[model samples]
Target chain A: MRRRIPQLVCGLFGLVTFLCYFSSHPIARKIYLTVTLDYWQIIFAFTLIVGALSFVRVNLRAVERGEDRPYKIVSLIGVVLMPILALIWGIRGGSPFMWVFENIQVPMQATVFSLLAFFVASASYRGFRARSLQAAILLGAALLILISRSSIGDLIWDRIPEAAEWVRSNPAMSARRAILIGIGLGSLTTSVRVLVGIERTWLGGEK
Target chain B: MDVGTLVAGLLTLAILTFLYRDNPIYKMAESLLIGVAIGYVLVVTWTNSLMALLFTPLFSRGELWLIVPFALGFLMFGRLHRRTAILSRIPIGVLIGSGAGVAIPAMLEARTLRQLSATVGPVFADGTVDISMVVVLLGVLSTLIYFYFSREQVGWWGRTARLGTWFLMIFFGTTFGYTVMSRMSTFIGRMEFLLSDFLRIIS
Candidate 1:
C-alpha cells in the first residue's frame, strides 16, 4: 500500500499530463495546468517541512555534542519561535515576522552576493589576460560591455552602449538560449522517468 | 518612506559592508537573513501548498485522492532507514522520467536546430541579404572558424578562418568582464537595501 501510493500519483496525473499536450481536448490543457501549477505546487510547498525538521535535528545534535552550542541554540530558537509567531499572527508587509524577514534575510543574501564582487575583481585582475585570438575577442567584448554599463563608459565612448547591446542581443542571448535548451532537455529526461514510475528517488529509495 | 521599507534598507547596507571588510554589522545582517529565509519557507509552504492544495481539497471534495501525492511525499522520509532506503527510487524515477519527456524535445529544438538554423538563417531569410544580414553572416562565419583548431592554414581559407577566430576571442573576453561587474552590482544592491532598511530598527 505504501509503495503503490506515489506510483499511483505519477501514473494518474503524469500520464494525463503527457497525453494532454497532444490531445485537441481543451480539458487536457486545463488539467495539465492544474496538475502542474496546483497539484505539484502543493507537493513542493510541503517539502519545506522536511527541511525544517532536518534543521532542528542537526542543530539539536550539535547542542548535544557540546560544539558551537551557543549558535545552535540561537538557531533553534529562531527556527522555532519565528514560525510559531508567524502562524499565530501571520506574516505579511507590516507584521513583525515580516519585518524580521526583510531586515535580516535580504541582507544575508545580499552580503553573500557582495562578497562575490571582490572575488570577481580579484579574478579579473589575475586571469583577464589574452592568450589567443579567441581570448582577445572575448576581452574586447568584455571591455565594450563594462564601459557601457557604468556612467564612466558613457562619457568616454558613446558607441559603447550600442555595441554592447548588439553583442548581448545577438551572441550572448543566442548562447544562453542554447544552454537553456540543453538544460530543458535534461529536465525532460528526469520528468519522463518520474512519470513512468521508473525514477522514484524522490520517493526515498528505489522500488 | 514607509517604516517597513526603511528598516529593510538598513539591513541591506549592513550586508554590503562585507564588500570592504567583515564586521559586527555584517554578522548582524547575516543572522537576520538566515532567520528570514527559514521563516519565509515555512510561511510560504503553509499558505501556498498546505492551505491551498491539501486543505482546500479536503474541505471541498472530501475526495481521498488528495492523499496520493501526500503518501508518496512521506515516502521521502524512508531515506532515514538503513536497509530499506532504496525505496526512495520510486518517486525519483517518476520525477526523472516525466522530466525527460518534456525536456528532450525542448532541448533538441531549442539548442540544436534553432542555433544551427539561426546561424545559417539571415542570408536566406526573405531570400536576400541586406547590410545587417551581411554583418551577421560575417560574424557567424568568423566565430565558427575561430573554433577550428586543427585546420591547416596556408591559403585563403586559412586566412579567413584566422580572422574569424580573432573576432570570436575579443567578443568572449569583454563578455566575461561585464558578467563579473553585473554579479558585483547584484551583491551591492542587496547590501544597500539591507543597511538602508534594517538599520532603521535600531535608529
Candidate 2:
C-alpha cells in the first residue's frame, strides 16, 4: 500500500508536468521550481545523515571487535572536532575548525589530484594508437588538442596551432554535437520513465 | 621558502608516491579528501535545505507554512522504524509529484527543440568557408539516417544507411577522444592544485 500510493501520486504529477510543456503559465513555473527545490533538499538531508552514521558505526565496531583500527579513531575525532568547534566559535577564521579545513582538507584534496597527472599520461599513451582509419583520425585530433593546449607546441611551431584550430572547429565540435543529440534522447526517455514511476531506481530500487 | 609552499610540495610528493606503489601518504591524503567532502555536504545541507525549508518556517513568527515541510521531513525519518516505514510514503509521494511537475518544460526547451534547431540549419554562412557547419550537417544526416528502423533499406537507401553507419562510428570515436581529453584536463587541473596551492613546490 505504501509503494502503491507513491507510484500513483508520481504518475499524476508526471502527467501534469508533461502537460505544463504545452503552456507558459507563471503558476505552472512556480510549481515546477518549488518541486525541484524540495527534491534537492531531500537528497542532501538523506546524505548528511548517512555520512554521520558511517563515522559512528565503523569506529564503534572497530573498538568493540579490537581490530587494527587506529585510523578509525582519527576519523571519528575529526568528525566530532569540527562540528563542536563550529558550534562554539563558528566556522570563520581564527578558529581551529576552519584552520583544520584549510590546512588539512584542501591540501589533501590537492595531494590526491596530483596523482592523476601520471594516470592521465599513462591512459593517453595506451589509448591513442593509430592502427585503424578511425584510430588515425582520433590520433590526429588528439595531437592537435595536446599541442594547442601546451606552451611547447607554440614555441617551436605555428602551423600546429592552425591545424589544431581546424581539427577542433570542424571534426571535434561536430562529433561532440552528435553525441549530445543521442544523449539528449536518452535523457528524455529517462525523465519520462521517472515521471511515469517506471524508473524507480533513482528513488532507491524497485518495490 | 614559506611553510605553505614547503608543505604543498611535500603533499605533492606524498601523492605521487602512489605512482610507484600505494603507501601511508596516499592513505592519509585519501582520508583527508573524504573527510572534507563529507563536512562540506553536511554544512551545505544544514544551511541550504534544512534552514530554508524546515527551520525558518517552523520557528519564525507569522509563518504557518512551516507545518507542511516539517511534517514531511518527519515523515521521511519514519523509515528508521520498521513498523512505520508505511508513513514514509507520504513524503515520498510529495517528492515525486513535485519532481515531475518541475522537469517538464525545462527538459523540452534545453534538450529537444534547441538541439533539433541546431541540426536543421544551412551548412554555409554568407557563402564563406565553414568546415564546422558542413561537418555538423553531414554528421546530423548520417546519424539520423543510420537510425532509420521504420523503413525498408533494400536499394540505394541501403547504401546510404551503410555510409551512415560508418559516419556514426567515426563520430563516436571522435567523441570518445574528446571525452578522454576533458577528463585528463580535469586530472591535470587537480594535480596543479596540489602542487601550487597545497604543497607550494611549483609556481
Candidate 3:
C-alpha cells in the first residue's frame, strides 16, 4: 500500500503537470501555478527544516560520543542560536540575525571559497602537463584565457584578447550548446520515467 | 576597527589558516560557518516560504486549500522516525513528480529546441560563409557525435569523435581558467578587506 500509493500520487501529479503545459484553461493554469510556486516552496521548506533537525541530531550524537565535542558544540550553538536570534530580534536590517549573516556568514563563506584559489593554482601545476596533443591544447587554451584576462596580455600582443574571445564564442560555445541539448533531452526522458513510475528509486529499498 | 569589521576580519583570518594546515582554528570556523549557514537558511525559509505561503494564507486569511500543503509538509517530519519514515515518500514523490513534469516542457523548449534552432539558424544566415559560424557548427556536431555511444567508434566516426575531444578540452580549459580567475579575484578581495579594513595597511 505504501509503495503503490506514492507511485500513484507521483504519476497523478506528473501527468497533471505535464498536461497543464498544453492547457490554456484557467483551472489548469491555477493548478500549475499553485503546485509550482506555493506547494513547491512549502514542501521544500519542510525538507530544509527536516535536514536542519537531522544535522542537529548528528552533531548531538557526535558530542555524546566525545568526538571533537568542542567543534560539534560550536556547530550546535550556531544552529540553535541563529533561529532564536531571528525569532527575537527579527531578520531585518540592523537585527542580530542580519548582523551574523553579514559579518559572520558572508565573510567566512567568501574566505572559504577564496581559499580555493590557492588549491586551484596547486592543481593547475599538476593538471597543465602537456605530454599529449590534447593536453597541450588544453594548456594553451587556459594560458590564452588567463593571459587575455590579465593586464600583461596586451603588453605581449594586442590580438591575444581577440583570439581568446574568438575561441570562446566559436568552439567553446558549440560545446556548451551541445551539452545543453544533451541535458535537455536527458531531463525530458527522466521526467517521463518519473511520470511512468519507472523511477521509483526515490521510494527507497524494500517497497 | 569597529566590532563588525574586527569580527569579520578575525573570522576571515581563521578560515584562511588552512593554508598553513588544518587545525583547531580552521575547523572551528568551518563548523560555525556550516551551522550558521543552516540557521540562516532556516530563518529565510520559515519567513519566505512557510510563514508567508502556508501559515499566512491558511490561518490569517482563512484560505482552507493551504491545509493540503500543510499536511504534506507535516508528512515531511515523518522522516524523523523509522516507523513514520515511509510517510515522507508521499511528499517526495509529489515534489519530484511535479518538478519532473514542469521540467519536461521547459527542458524541451529552452534547452533542446532553442539550442538546436540557434545552432542551425546562424549557419543558414544569408547563405554566406562566416568562418566563426562554421567553426561553431562543426564544434556542436562533432561534440554531439562524440557523445553518441550507440555505435562503435572507428574510421571517420573515430576522427570526428576525436575532434569533439579537442573542443571539449578547450571548453574545459576555458572553464577552469575562468574558475581560477574568479577565485583569485575573491581572494584578492579578502586581502583587500584585511589590509584596508582591519589593518589599515592599504588605502
Candidate 4:
C-alpha cells in the first residue's frame, strides 16, 4: 500500500502537470502555477531544512563520538550562530547575519573555489597529453581559447581571438546544440518512465 | 583595518592554505564555510519560501490548499526515521512528478525543437552560402548520428561519428578553457584582496 500510494501519486501528478501545459483552462493554469510555484518552493525549502538538520545531527553525533571534535564544534557553532544572529538582528542588509555571510561565508567560498584553478592547472599539466588526433584537437582548441582570452595572444597574433571565436560559435555551438537535444529527449523519456512507475528507484529500494 | 576586511582577509588566507596542503586551518575554514552556508540557506528558505509562500498564505490569507504542501513538507522529516521513511516517498513522488511534467514541454520546446529550428533555419544569407551555418548544420547532424547506437558504427557512418567526436572535443575544450579562465579570475580576485585590501602592498 505504501509503495502503491506513492506510485499513484507520482503518476497522477505527472499526468496532471503534463496535461496542464496543453490546457488553457484557468483551473489547469492555476494548478500548474500553484504546484510549480508554491508547492515546489515549500517542498524544496523543507527538503533543504531537513538536509541541514541532518547535517547538524550527524555532526553532533560525531562530536559525541570524539571524532574531529574541535572542527565539528566549530561547524556546529557556525550553524547555531547564524540563526541566532538572524533571529536577533534579522537578515537585512548590514545586519550581523549578513556581515558573517559577506565576510566569513562568501570570502571562504570564493577562496575555496579559486583554489580549483591551481588544481586544474596542475591536473592539466599532468593529463593534457596530445598524443592522438582528438587529443591534439582538444589541446589546440583549449590553447587557442586560453590565448585568445589573454592580452599576450593579441600581441602575438591579432586574429587569434577571431579564430577562437569562429571555433566557439560554429563547431562548438553545433555540438552543444546536439547535446542539448539529446538531454531533452533523455529527460522526456526519464520523466515518462518515472511517471509510469518504471523508474521506481526513487521509492528507495525493495521495501 | 575594518573588522570585515580583516576577518574576510584572514579567512581567505586560511582557505588558500589548502593549496600548500590540507592542514587544520584549511579544514577548520572549510567546515565553518559549510555550516555558515547551510545556515544562510536555512534563513533564506525560511524567510523567502516558508514565511512568504507557505505561512503568510496559510495563516494570514487563509489559503486552505496550502495545507497540502505543508503536510507534504512535514512528511519529508520521515526520512530521519526508518519506521516512517516510506511516508517520505509521497512527497518525493509529487516533487519528481510535477518537475518532470513541467520539464516535458519545456525541454522539448527550448532544447530540442528550438535547436532543430535554429539549425535548419538558414544555410544561405545575402546571396552567398553562409559557411558557418552549413558547418553548424553538419556538426549537429554528425553529433546526433554519433549518439545513435542502434546500428554498428562502420564505413561512412563511422567517419561521421568520428567527426562528431572531434566537434564534441572542441566543445569540451572550449568549456574547459572558459572554466579555467573563470577560476583564474577568481584566483586573481583573491590575490588582489590579499595584496591590496589586506596587506596594502598595492593601491
Looking at model 4, residue B167 earns an lDDT score of: 93
Candidate 1, position A114, lDDT = 63
TM-score of chain A of 1: 0.81
Model 3 CA deviation exceeding 4 Å by range = B124-128
Residue pairs clashing in model 2 are B8-B198, B8-B199, B9-B199
Minimal lDDT window, size 10, model 4 chain B: B118-127
> For residues A1-207, what per-residue lDDT tens digits would candidate 4 score against the true structure?
989999999889989999998899999999999999988999999999889989999999999999999999999999888999999999999999999999999999999888999999999999999999999989998999999999898999999999999999999999999999999999988988888889889888857
Per-model root-mean-square deviation over C-alphas = 5.3, 4.1, 1.1, 0.9
Which 10 successive residues of model 3 chain B have the least lDDT summed? B120-129
Query: Candidate 1: deviation at residue B166, Å?
Result: 6.7
Clashing pairs in 3: none
Q: Write the per-residue lDDT of candidate 3 for residues A149-199, one digit (tens) a residue.
A: 998999999999999999988898899899999999999999999899888
Give the per-residue lDDT digits (tens) of candidate 2, residues B2-47.
5555555565566667888988766665555565556655665676
Runs off by more than 4 Å, candidate 2: A16-26, A66-68, A201-207, B1-11, B78-97, B127-129, B144-203
RMSD of 3: 1.1
- Tens-place lDDT per residue, model 2, A159-180, is 7778666655554555455556
Q: TM-score per candidate, in order?
A: 0.75, 0.80, 0.98, 0.98
The candidates, ranked best first by TM-score, are 4, 3, 2, 1
Error of 4 at A82 (Å): 0.8
Model 1 over residues A1-207: C-alpha lDDT tens digits? 556765674465566666765667888777656655655565466456766776778778888999767656666766776788687778777787776666556545656766777777787778767786566566677877778888888799788788788777665554443344445555666666766667655554334
